[model samples]
Every structure is written in structure tokens, then in C-alpha cells.
Target: MAEVAAITEREIELISRFVVLLKDEQDALKRADPSVLQEIGAEKIGLAEQLNTLEADRRLALGITDDQNTREAMAGWLAQHPEESTAAVNWEKLLELSREAKQLHELNAGLVAMHLQLASDALTILTRQSEQHHALYGSDGQAAPVSGSRIVDSA
Candidate 1:
């Protein structure tokens, strides 16, 4: 049916958009831009919701009320409509892009974790050094020791 074809096109578009978003997110992570990353996260959330709705519509268009029937319906429809067989190709492309997006996300997460660990290590070193040193040198060029408090503050 025309509705099924339209839904398939919409799905391909959405998957393409998802792949683009994933690439943008990966770039944001690479640049270490928290604000940009947050913006990208919001965008990804919106896209995810859109994709979920589109998926439901697709299932409905294919007469697939349950997920178990999806493959069977899709195969039958493709067999009946040889002209629209390209939908299966598009579906394959979507799957490939989805897999790529997942891998990129995983890599981004690992990069973020590495950065966090580096920051934590640096903070630890700074805090340890600050704890060992009581105070800085006074105007007299002599080391000024504090009574009982560690001077240099860390968050």
C-alpha cells in the first residue's frame, strides 16, 4: 500500500537523521564541549522520541500489531510489491547506520570516561601537594607555615 511505502521512506529519513545526530554528538565529545554536548543530548532525545513514534506508525502501516509478526508481514509485502522492493535495501541501510551509531556512542562514552579519569588524577595530585604544603612564601621570601589548616583549597 501507499501508506506502507510512505512509512518506509519516513523510516529511512529518520535513520539518516539519527546517524547525523550521532556524528554530531561524536564531534562534540571529541571537542570536549560540555555545553555543545548537552545541546546535542537534548537533540538526540527529541530524535529518539520521533523515531519511536515513526516506528509505531511503520508497524501499523505494515499491519504489524505485534513485533513478532513484523518480519513475516514485511516479507509478504515485499513479495507482493516488487517495485517497492527497495524498501528492503533502505531497511538494511538503516540497520547499518544504527550499528554505526551505537559504536560511535560507545566510543564517545569511553573517551568521556578517560577524560574524567584524567581530571580526577590531576585533582588528586594537586590536592595531595596542597595538603603537604602548609602555606606559600610570605613577602619576606620565607616559607610561611600555617598552624593547623591546609591552605590551598580544592573542590
Candidate 2:
């Protein structure tokens, strides 16, 4: 029980940090700072890995296997040990924070997708303009005659 509480506390702390990191990611995305985004992304990945390990540890401490429904297991454990109300409250808070983190992650994904789409569109436009410019001029740097027009020989 003590071990579970400690693991839950660590999970909460890591998740809180993750939430902050996600917000920073959103700001970085808004500013289009690739360096900051890259750094924050690395940090977020590390936090996620840590959280996953802590979750596994918590499950083990609670005698819950991977196939068990974690929520049900937690509720059963909490019911069996009413004296550990703090752990129950912490678990609920952790769940809420996890949801918040997920939402922020989704929002960041959308922002990144939008940025990529805009970049692709700009590239397409530039490529088309380059092609048209090339078509308008010959290799000798002279205007290329239009297909429907002819050079008029004057007297």
C-alpha cells in the first residue's frame, strides 16, 4: 500500500510536469520555434517513458496484472483500504491530469499538421510559379513566342 502511494505520487508529479511541458509545446508551436519545439518534444518523450514505468510499478504494488482493468482494480483496492483515502484522491487527480495531457497533445498534433499543410501549399505555389517563369523565357534569356502567335515580317 505504501509502495503504491509512493508510485502514485511520483506519477502525479511526472504528469504535472508533462502538462507544463505540453503547454510549452503549444507556445513553441504558436511561435514556430523549431529548436524549442524539438527540445520540448524530447523532454515530453522522456516524461512519458517515466510515467509508463511508474504506472507499471503502481500496478504491481496494487497486485493488479496487465490484463486487469486498472480503474476497477484501483476502486477495489481503495474500497478494501478506506484508510488510504489520500491515494484514492491522488489517483483521481492523476486521471484528470492524464486527460488534460492527452487533450493538449492532440491540439499540438493539429497545430503541427496545419503548419505542415501550409508549408506544402507554399511549396506547391512556388514550384508552379517557377515552371511558368521558365516557360515564358528560353534558354538564351529571350521571350519564347506563344504557340498561337507568329512573328510578323514587315515590309
Estimate candidate 2's alpha-carbon lDDT, on a 0 to 1 scale: 0.86
RMSD per prediction, one decimal? 7.6, 5.2
Report the lDDT tens digits of candidate 1 across residue range 36-88. 87777888888889878877887877767764566577778778787875677
Sliding window of 10 residues with minimal summed lDDT for model 1: 146-155
Model 2, span 1-155: residue lDDT tens: 77777788899999999999999999988998878887888998999999989989988889989999998999899899988977988999999999999999999999999999999999999898656543555568986643433343110
- For candidate 1, the TM-score is 0.70
TM-score, cand. 2: 0.83
